[model samples]
Target: MNVSITGLTKEYGKKKALDAITMQLEGNKIYGLLGRNGAGKTTLMQILAGQVMPDGGEVLIGGQKPFENQAITESICLINESENFKKGMKIGDIFKFAGYFYPNWSLETAEKLLEEFSLDKKMKVKSLSKGMESALGITVGLASRSPITIFDEPYIGLDAAARSRFYDLLLEEYEVQERTFILSTHLIDEVSRLLEEVLIVSDGKLLMQKNADELREESFIVNGPRSDVSAFTAGKNVIHRKAFGSMEQAVLYGESKSDARKAGLNVEHVPVQELMVYLTEKTKGGVSA
Candidate 1:
């Protein structure tokens, strides 16, 4: 389902969690929701999942409001870091509940994944380890098959091996059944290749949103003598800069490599993780798409 937010606002006393956010997310695509801590990533996802109400503005899922609307809420599934399942509940019980909740839930897929993750069906929530809990959540998320499925930092206690398994399963399922997946994660480099689009939020506001491929195409760093680098980056969108002795490196947006080479500057492509770090670092202002 397509997600449309118009002037969405949320507040807690004097702090604004979301500030006049406005954007339309296309359907059946993977989006990497990138942001630092307290940058409103959770708030925005909650608003989309109908777990939190906005003080102002509207969120429409498939042209219908999601807040307090079962029609839309039933089609969306959000798996967060803390699931808060009952301590006495068994893993199999949770799967049964998911089957009842999500219309598209698959019991076959759930059972297969439970074995794949080495999670016992009879194990209670409280008895499982942290990584096991995360694996259970991942199992439900993939088997649920909701039209709009969101994962908000869902790999908190997972080890590297298990995390790699999750990524492989996610890609395999997504290939078989295309759906809108919003992955709000801090491991940008780990999941960069899975994202079709990118959304960056900073300081409770939307900073930038663009096609992942296009963003990479336009992002690069220029390094050379301070004077040459400065002159080459003149009037350009400079997100980050560093200098040592007579040398300088400037991370720029939308500057041509040929232009930088013409000005006697060395150019290199900026990795997505590095670009995101420098773009959102200590910046309160928003960047247009």
Candidate 2:
């Protein structure tokens, strides 16, 4: 289940969203897509899912083009943030429609999730609350059991408890049934633990790609005397730095484990969520998350 995207680019009039982006996503891995706003995460997902067309580049899923190919696209599910269910359609009707499109759709799992989320089937989509709408999308996404599952911030408007439920279910589904999962999100801290890989995009370009474990092992937070902390991270790419009184904390992105260890400073692994925040600072002039 390898998805190869080469030279992917998107433009809206004079503004470029994704500039010659290239990536290869292997099977059965959970990927965290991080970026600032306008970094083109949504555009990338939309193109991959065959919902939007890229101005240039090639997208190959399983060694074939995905655009306009139902056989391939049907196997890929994109649960986007803005899942607008029509006003007249009931929740059950939508589920029924999904069952027709996805051969691997699971009604039992869908029913259980519906009950857990307390979503009423008879209610109109327009009448449901924002959180409820998100829950409906999640239920369909999980039940689809598609080979490639891409979630674009599906937990928006969901409460903390609901979000936790989503995380648990996503992991459980992944463990029992190996599938490619790509998560584009702002809730990095909450979902970081589940990510096996991290892909960061900045200013419409691919900035970094690394194994989750390796990244955590290399990055750390250093706090000490101002001069000492600065000296510790003198040559490192400091994601963030702050000082209060004589004490200073500098978040350094080290390339090697030895670099972090030899610093001889207070060190803690970089939290994926926090790292995203620091790496994509507003002052850097791109997205917020």
User: What's model 1's lDDT at 113?
Assistant: 94
Per residue, candidate 2 scores C-alpha lDDT tens digits across 1-289 of 8999999989999989889999999988999999877788998888888887789998899988888989888998998887546778998898898899888899988898899899877878988888888998898888889999999999988989989989999998888788998999988889988999999987788877889988898677877788888877766677788899999987777555466567666777768877877777767412222
Q: Identify the leading candidate in terms of lDDT.
A: 1
Least accurate stretch of 10 residues (summed lDDT) in model 1? 280-289
TM-score of each: 0.95, 0.93
Q: CA lDDT of 36 in candidate 1?
A: 89
Candidate 1: the clashing residue pairs are: none
lDDT of 2 at 259: 61
Candidate 2 runs further than 4 Å off: 256-263, 282-289
TM-score between model 1 and native: 0.95
Each model's lDDT: 0.88, 0.84
| Clash totals, every prediction | 0, 2
